[model samples]
Target chain A: MSAVAAALPLADDALVLSHRLAEWLGHAPELEEELALANISLDLLGQARACYALLGDEDALAYRREEREFRNLQLVEQPNGDFAHTITRQLFFSVWQELLFGRVTGTGPPAAVAAKAVKETAYHRDHAEQWTLRLGDGTEESHRRTQRAVDALWRYTGELFQPLEGLDIAMEPLRRDWRARIGDILARATLTMPEGPDADAWSAGAGRQGVHTESFGRMLAEMQHLHRSHPGAVW
Target chain B: MISLAELGVLRDVRLLDGGRTAEVELTPTYTGCPALEAMAEDIRRALHTADPRLARVSVRTVLSPPWSTDDITEEGRRKLAAAGIAPPRRPGPARGPVPVALAIRCPRCGSTDTELISRFSSTACKALRRCRTCREPFDHVKEV
Candidate 1:
């Protein structure tokens, strides 16, 4: 597969999720949490920019693309429901990214990007894991909300293991490691592990094919509006 | 606030095309560091100010040999502490997500009873920390 084809999925994932996290800029529960979310968002945005730069003009790729052209995971496109939901989303996605980047090897932009990103994703996963533990084991309401969020987002987790077109990753081992890590974190947090996507026949796996959920369109509309309106505006 | 040189982000500088063109290389502290662009621009301006003969100054970002806190020079660490920001301890080796949990010293009172307030701070490279003895909140350059 072409390098652009391979990098597109990873880039799109970062871009979409970065935008989602940035939405919490002024709305986060606390000042420190806002800063943390923005920092993570910036990191993911940087990763996306690096990957996209390798293919073509990064702005054009990010802002000019239609909903059908994006190759990001459907899970990332899901709305940040609440603090717990966002943490659940981060936990699911960060574990997959950390595992995937850790296993990525070879000489290229992807490898170089992965080498640095693996470290960043490790922190992201830890942040998510910490919040998961607090929410899962804290007050009774917190536990209920945390479990509800996890259950709601569980199906989307399966799509993460779905292999991209050009990336040379062992899907089985990646899937296994992801499952084991998620299971362990949930067990520690006093939360029940949700059923695997394999158990349910209709797991999400279509984002790589350029198909996205309904909310993704709205997100893209907001994200692309400024660039779409102005042909070549720059800061 | 330490200079990139002290932080060890600036890698190399070379004059190509018989000194008419200058090429500079830099590695970022993090993959998505926003300061990189500003740093590059600063280099370009500094080069022009120092010597107007150079017709071109190009800044390239290199990712190979990923940067770590160990790259920070002793001078850098000293400056960091002097500026009231705790410098990271020597991160022994690259390991898994389980941090070694080294006791961080407070830059203010020189106390080892500092606690992490947040894993992240104003920038991606720093973490928010507070000291028990001094009771002063400060930023700690994370050991990555």
Candidate 2:
């Protein structure tokens, strides 16, 4: 794939996930959590903006793209089901992003962006892991809910191991490292690992090819609504 | 003149054609910061006022060596603290997989008994912290 093609999917992943995290503003469990989530969202949005700027106008690329044109991973497009679900999603994605960016730093097309982003992704992954441990080991109710989230999101994790065309990093080691790290976290959290599909099993995801979950359409519509309504409007 | 240099955004400035034209390079503290455009406009205005015969004033943004809190000058730190916004702690080791929380001294009381209330604040570059000694909530410049 071309450099633009490679960047578009990664950019879309950040943009879509950022919007989902932004939805937690005013709805998070507490003020601190709200701030934290919003900050994470903003960080992701920043990454998206940087990536999109490499192609064309960041706003137009983000706000004007149709659902069919978006190339985000299905994991990001998944709805933020609850606090546990959100944390789970973040933990999974951040781990992959931190590892991916780490591998691509100084070598890939987006190396400059990755160099900065890996640092941010490290913090993001740490935040999610901390929360995962807290919720998974805290109480009976919390553990149960967190376990359910883990199980529900397990299928989407496979896509992270899939290869992107232009990024030259090896996927096998990344997948191995991701599993080992996630397993260690799960063990520490006292959370039961979900019986994920076999490594060789056919994984279900195509967002890199512009295919997305049903919920993505609704989310994209809402995200683009304001921009579409007021063309060339500025605050 | 609005001091973009003191704001830690201006990376470099040059005068060409015997000071007739001005060229400035800027780096934003955060990628999505809304102030970059305003900062560029201010630079142009300031350059024009400095030399009415200036042939041209050009502003460029560079991101190669990303901006960090360490870029804030000592004077800038004083200005920020005076304005009730805490200056960032000297950056620690580079970020790694395990995120370590650094001990930030309280800007108000100069006490080391500050705790992070949140990892993020209203702005992208600040974190919410509170000083236990003074029992006051404040914002700390986040180490990016």
* Model 2 quality (TM-score): 0.89
Query: What is the per-residue lDDT of model 1 for residues A66-128, given as tens digits with 9 covering 90 to 100?
Result: 999999998999999999999999999999999998888887778888888888898899999
Which one wins on DockQ?
1
DockQ of 1: 0.81
Residue A197 Cα positional deviation in candidate 1, in Å, after optimal superposition: 3.4
Docking class of 1: high
Q: Which residue runs of candidate 2 sit more than 4 Å off their true CA positions?
A: A1-4, A107-109, A198-205, B1-3, B16-21, B91-102
**Residue by residue across B20-96, what tens digits does model 2's lDDT show?**
88889988777656577888998899889988999899998776677877888888888888766788877658789
Mind giving the per-residue lDDT tens digits that candidate 1 earns over B22-87?
A: 999999999899889999999999999998999999999998778888899999999999998889
Off by over 4 Å in 1: A2-4, A196-205, B93-100
